[model samples]
Target: MNRAAHLLLFAALALPLAACSKVTADNYSRLKPGMAYEDVRGILGKPDKCSDLLAARSCTWGDDKSYISVTFVGDQAVLFQSENIR
Candidate 1:
């Protein structure tokens, strides 16, 4: 093959591998709504900061990579939202 043909073939082969490390929605897909706070913590690891409101049965977890604020009532998550910061 000519030089130009070889370069094109190589670029086409490398494109798929180049995008393999991207983070997608699937990474956090297993975290279903209504899961316990502990389970969510286990899946996402420790948060950068967390606070508890005694009157409200909920916790706000602020992570460097994502914000996961979950409401819990008797060990059950009633509300949850996860978003990427980076």
Candidate 2:
């Protein structure tokens, strides 16, 4: 491959990695009781897992380093927790 094509390929591969956002305390601070599910998704992107129940739903976002879990009643967030994964 030519130099320009190699550079283009490198950039194309790196762009997606740059766009990935990690869950952080700042993201957790954005959550509030009664916040809508769509609103939470807006701030945190998408959860790694989600569980739907009869009257509530829960979503978890995490990696090997940290995690945040939010529980929603109806469409609004009612409880949430965050912790470092050791």
Candidate 3:
């Protein structure tokens, strides 16, 4: 293959790996009680989904088989859970 073709192939292969989520054990451990939503967002980028009920907000990242969920009250995280995150 030519040089440009090789470079294009490399970029295509690397893009998805670069875009992988940061929902790993190391980042999960960094979470603590009373952390603000913005703080968690800084580490996890964005939740896959979020819901609000009264003053409590629940947010989750990643898919069902491998995910992280956190419960926040008044913008402060109070509880968190994870599944199959390495």
Predictions in order: lDDT: 0.62, 0.88, 0.95
Winning model by lDDT: 3
- Rank all candidate structures by their TM-score, best first, as comma-separated numbers: 3, 2, 1
- Model 2: per-residue lDDT, tens digit, 1-86? 99999999999999999766657788888899999999999988889999999989999988646788999999999999988732
Which digits, one per residue and each the tens of the lDDT, describe model 3 over residues 1-86? 99999999999999999878789999999999999999999999889999999999999999889999999998999999999999
lDDT of 1: 0.62
Task: List where candidate 3 sits over 4 angstroms from the true fold.
Answer: 1-7, 10-19
Model 1 misplaced stretches (Cα beyond 4 Å): 1-24, 55-66
Per residue, candidate 1 scores C-alpha lDDT tens digits across 10-81 of 999999986553233453565676787778677655544555666346554444465555677667777766
In model 2, the Cα lDDT at residue 84 comes to 74
Q: After best superposition, candidate 3 residue 10: deviation in angstroms?
A: 7.2
lDDT of 2 at 3: 100
Model 3: colliding residue pairs? none
From the highest lDDT down, the ranking of the candidates is 3, 2, 1
- Per-candidate TM vs. native? 0.47, 0.76, 0.82
Which residue pairs clash within candidate 1?
Answer: none
Q: What is the lDDT of residue 41 in candidate 1?
A: 70
10 residues in a row with least lDDT, candidate 3: 17-26
